[model samples]
Target: MSEKRIEELRRQIQYYRDAYYQENQSLISDYDYDLLERELKSLELAHGVAEGSPTVLVGGKASEVFAPVKHLTPMMSLDNAFSEEEFLAWSQRAGGGPFLCEPKIDGLALSITYENGVLVKAATRGDGETGEDVTQNVLTIQGVPHRLSGSNHPAVIEIRGEVYFPLKAFEKLNADLVAAGKPPFANPRNSASGSLRQKDPAVTASRPLRMLVHGFGSFEGLNTQSEVYQLLESWGLPTTKQFAVAQDATSAYKFITQLSQKRHDLEHEIDGVVVKVDELSRQRELGATSRAPRWAIAYKYPPEQVNTKLLDIKVSIGRTGRATPFAVLAPVKVAGSEVEFATLHNQDQVRAKGILIGDTVVLRKAGDVIPEILGPVVALRNGSEREFVMPTHCPECSFELAPAQEGDVDLRCPNAESCPAQLRERIAYIGSRAALDIEALGYVSATALTQPLEPSQPPVQSEADLFDLTLEKLLPIRAYVLDPDTGLPKHDADGNPKIVDFFRKKDGSPAEVALKLLANLEEAKTRELWKILTSLSIRHVGPVAARALCNEFGSIEKILQASEDELSQVDGVGPTLASSIKDWYQESWHQRIIERWKASGVQLEIPDFAGPVLTDGIFSGMTIVVTGSMQSMTREDAEAKIIAQGGKASSSVSKKTSFVVAGPGAGSKLAKAEELGIEVIDEATFIARLAS
Candidate 1:
């Protein structure tokens, strides 16, 4: 193959890949794409073509389950330069001029193809050179546009983007999983990958996965870095918001530094910055290494690590009763803050890293957010180092720990009702915004309030006791009271509290203020049954689940008296949650607490739903699916409309779907709707239907 022909073929193949992967609309069918690829391979074989050959693979094989294929161009890993010194060295080697510094998204890399402005194919990075054809999955991502907006468009375009799960979505997903008696995912990266690799495209579509275009895999007409990014944005593709034209490496480093500080506030995760030569001509002039383009380099942020001693390893019981181990370390500075503890993740992680008590471990904070133990210093281990063991019983309640059922790794405490740790967590959760929505009783305060006094001399043993305690009793000498005016604590000349600090108030005086606060709490008991029940902190019951229970049972007293079978009958309340709730209410101590609260004049009334209910509508009893970008309103707003019209807004498209509301760049959901023979309506049609 001639050099010109090889370049043309490479460009065409790249364009097709982008169409299929980055864009949801396919201009050419799979057959045509395959034919083009085969022809390119044939041409390369015919001519001993080495430079710019379409046959130069970059991605890996598609599994048989996925149909594995290797990349023509080896998808080489970037040599990360973390500091200015390292970047300067890289730039010196490349003889740098102007560069483009872009945000480094923490996501899975993918390649996409576009033909005549229509999306056609999408694939993962896989092994870099060859990747699984994930066109179906890519279509589900919110950022990939189905069709370009402008009439004049590129003949073929290939783009690359990082697909990620947003932090909010990840947290919500994990919360839902925990509510269902399943383990939560550790982080968004793993969740994103797992969601994308699902066999069912519909399943992947349900996850809040987003895509951000970062670079061009192949392009026919685009010449400059700015032009490519602008073209992507014009096509409704999500591109990295942070991009700057730097005249030199120093400017590029400055841009990177500014972005690094703002990284923590971004909705999506970013690890570092990517600096590329701005001018396409200059990029070509400074051309390729055998691995990476000489005009481009990734400048990663230094790993924020701190040296801290492992004071102890303790097991924490989660909302699901699963016990997770974490390390309590001596306070050490890392990532601009003092960190005294880090998650051990799991037994597997602990064993893998050979972490032990008394071992000096390296704690790393990524993006100045999550702190995790890197590993122990093997050479520094001494005779004092002790192997940590997971307890067979709950440390709080002494209940036997049971192995999680199939598909779970953690052990769980069976004693849900009597476990102080479980009860405390439950109460804290209830006080959370997602639960009882209690504004006054925060997690820390709730924890302190719920804690039983000394076993030998029990104080405030029941909920009624809380109402009887004086303000002096509740206040601790060290607790600071926020001054309503300044939002800070009021201090005396010596920097002590003007009024004794809550902690200090306990110094041999009856807590009159605590008693008054207890009285206020007693008055609030009548506020709503849902608030009362939720605030009690039953296991596996979140705010939604609590509301569901309230909707089923009329009041808190009714829910408390309900049997496991009766509680399980409520919609969204499963056997596990039912058992947990039942066990909690059935306990003598818990019953005593409730009785005391009742005696203290705490009312348990159900709050009325404020929203108007649709008695009759086309949407009533219908399940609707919303997909892609809506111009008139946000996706959330559209979903709210569906719910308001008495329709059930489902995350994924299924056979039961009544209709699919699609918008610009509607992806996998649209395809799934077509496959399932479900009716698909555009934003206008959806609005019209809702009106009708």
Candidate 2:
């Protein structure tokens, strides 16, 4: 079990690493990725470690498009500390000291070499040992000096620095890209990386790129890291003025805290603070690890909150027909990603947050979690800001909207089966990784099939019609790629909707996406019964409940026939889920969907060799709730381990919950557990309990 989990973690980490380093894309935020790697490192320490484990790896392989250059000295990555305790622990390990603390610039690392006071070559920090030679592109950056000043430099020196896009420039660049009908880059770091790696030096030169010296590889003259920076500045190279030599760990931490407070004021993004032993002799004495220097560690700040104009408040219809209000904001960067829309949950939440249209709102995004509207900057509001009004009718279908139950905060559209917006979301959900995992049937494909721009009749009106689609049916499909959160068409600079012939080329031939989707639909029919159940969009019935139901009943027919009491008897399927499943199946439209899917040859029975049933184990009948950031494992992995031990991993805290595993940053759930007098344990205690 440990081996299986370790392999899974390794695979996940490798995928993200490759995306960030090779593809110049950030699939997840830095903090979330760090948590995953931390979990993997912890797991490897407990269970045997692998040779190629990401925990022991540094950066990624150099791109084949560029010539590889071996570094004079390896450019290792830095281990991260998310909390002060962790930072202090590193300081203790380094034998306490006056340390140099500098902002950990969120950018691409570059190693520039100078021979006889003349800038010669620049390369990326690819896999630490070898890098992609990008001398031409690096020379294009404004702050990178072509030649040293005053000529007192070493005969040969390798300067390590970060190549970054200034915040203002990044914003303008994104605007320019949007104006040119091109997709904007995700963040400044990715934009900088993509610009630096451009094959054409002219293209790189056109971008607003800058550099900041952070360290050096083969500088014989420098006695300390701080001296290296001063020397770099003297040589007409750019260096950060933010660096300081702190007398102790407390002072170092103080510096980090102060920097974090004004992080947004900086010209370039700084995700964390790098604290290192100031003296070169001590750095060597402390030595190094395979992946990072033991003398240095990065203290990462929590997710950032930024202010953006709340252009308007709009409602988005979900797969469950729930009408959720979201804030349409002037796009802004937050937590290393561009955030334009943030969910306000429902009407009550909008009122609670005191957010008004045209007001400056505080937006917070943590890791890859969805952006959240914390509240309005009430002080910044002018007379122009207006209150949001919830619509009486469904925006998509023009059907009357009402709460599912009396006094409920949320409103829902009753036209669930045929509402284009709801159907689009449901079809897209079916293709999500948690459901059927159909790669080709994404949000764009879902919208094209259900709500085409050149609409006569859409190719698909319901998910039931999804499998029946043919090339002829899909050939005429055209749609604008609508923003999933706002349901508004994306437009070009001239304010025209960007219509895509989703299933065909401009020349009218069937496109690759169309053929792939058809093949995927056929393949989806044979997926495990759990996936089919999950794809049904049944209220409150997700992967866990679906798997439990399939394991107990084996077939969808048996589940359909089962009473609510019988359904609730399955592990992880409580009365609420059972009722929801029962209510869902009783709808005529849902029944038709099932019948159509059955006729379409979808396997609705559990496979014969469906792995272990997991009916009994150490934690049998116990409902465990794990919350916050666990140091030893991710919440998902923790839940999986709990389930493997015959426990029901629940999301909420209630009277029936056996206990709660609380870690750092545990919030409302921990409070609820304490209020309910339920037993609570730390992650370490919980892990030990699992072992016992």
Candidate 3:
């Protein structure tokens, strides 16, 4: 119980925590770590030691740049267990009925406060005690809900979530950084942290930052994570849809295993599973131990790394035209798959690590994803290593690349229309379900149909030819086929049919199975007209744009004949998109394809928009903030009614908020509204008001 003893324990525990969480390494076993934590807790309890005590909760401190905002409830770090044995032991100590296991996302912790169901403030988990306000930056995140819906609005709610940069986005960002002669971030977590910490809110907003609400920091009425998550969803906050309600520890472990396998598909970064008691009563019974909740523990996954030979370094031009270098590696086992490539990111990355062709580089699949060249081993490098150079022209089209606008290092392909890569990508975008309703075609299928059929041979000459593609003919088109026999492409004598033989069956005949798929596309043309226009592979046109274009022009044929000036008049269609749309329609082949599609019986009918029907009397013209629980209707449905009634549904409550709809266990929002003198209406009262 001495001061020296407490200080020593705090230092040791901090070291271990850092090593385990940040370094992904453990110096001692879970038992040893638990013992240290227990000793520290006992010392604090006996001597009333608080300052710098190991038992003192850590995390959520306000940064110097932003004014400190005190949390209604202190944010706490979760207890961690790296092994199953440790987890079982912790469960035994807690004596719980069930536990909820969630992925421990490797990202920055954030707290979003909603007033009357509208997002008002977002702050980082600065110190576990206080946090720096980053409201403006938070607004930029597309995933973060700007407004809430429904009749159930908490007066005030503080929802906690993890903001992370996805692997794909991180790679793209690092690629830009490298091309700009800047150092790439260490990992997605670091990238997310750096992005969120930017002084300029605009800079943070520009990044592909996403968030997932995992828990609540303070809720007036919400008592459990499950309830809180449901409430968050009702308020249009982004919560993980994959959360499982495990009945017991065994089920919890099973859920963890299931999530581990599926985590890679998730957009955010997750390092481990977070296990917590599902029941609020049980969680209260389990209580806390000063630093972490006894009800929750984070089950950390083992770090994954791999060794791969750098076969070559290639530069890829992005949408922005920035050339990013990546390592084409000799297939090596990492995470769960054979990683054949790792992102070199940018030129700065290549320079910093000296990544070269023929180098044996250490590759790490962080969070079980995104193969990245950790660094090259100088000792392993031979004299034959080749340096990579940024490409001056588009690799696909040889078009001169243009640098980004002033103060930007990214380069973009100025040839947006003629560039094959951009063209293909554009096709994929137009053909997406939301845009064109092209059910039979996807990016891969469309690419296969569009790619050059033979060496120096033109691709399926026109979109009309796509309709002509029979399964049998497609099998020999090496670009479209996957050989059934070898699970690899069956090469032709000249190797020119690499893609052709790929789609073929083992019998050398076009696969009947493949034919059936193409036949379905033939039938889908009769389904709708929007499908045809959306499938035209127009540049910069997505489903929303396609719909807008269709609504304005009436049909694909009409849209094509329209001048650029006329096309630009559409709600969402800008000048660039208008030119692309006009150009696509002007193409001789494109016109022929449209004729073929119409002949095939595709009908493009304008969707009928019925006038708004009001359901309730009181809700008309009144702005409502929905935050907490609602048993009557799903949040989406509730919002629809509000909008239908000419009323607005918001996410957070503010001074302008007319009323807060408080449902069962309405949390912090309720308390905040009381303080602000905002009228709080319960679900019953809300329904009554609607009826009135």
- Ranked by lDDT from best down, the candidates are 2, 1, 3
Q: TM-scores, in order shown?
A: 0.49, 0.55, 0.47
RMSD to native for every prediction?
16.0, 20.4, 14.4
Compared with the true structure, what per-residue lDDT tens digits does model 2 show for residues 1-692? 87888899899999988888998866665766877888888888889677888888899989999999999999999998989999999999998878999999989999999998888999999999999999999988897888988767788889998999987688677667655755456677888999999999999999989999887896565688888777778888888988999999999999998777556546788889999999998898888889999999999897565667889888889888899988888998877789889988888767655567997765767554579775554444469988799999999999999998899888999888878889999999998876898999988888888888655468788778888989999998778888766788989999998888889998899999999999999999998787799889998987677778887888888888899999988877889999888888888888888888889989988668464376678889999999877776767567757776888889899999999987755667887897899999988998888789
The 10 consecutive residues of candidate 2 with the worst lDDT sum are 373-382
| Alpha-carbon lDDT, every model | 0.67, 0.84, 0.66
lDDT of 3 at 16: 65
TM-score between candidate 1 and the true structure:
0.49
lDDT of 2: 0.84
Model 2 pairs whose backbones collide: none
- Model 3: lDDT equals 0.66
Worst 10 residues of 1 by lDDT: 479-488
lDDT of 3 by residue, 347-409 (tens): 666776646678766577744336777555444455998877778888877988766457655
RMSD of candidate 1 to the truth, in angstroms, is: 16.0
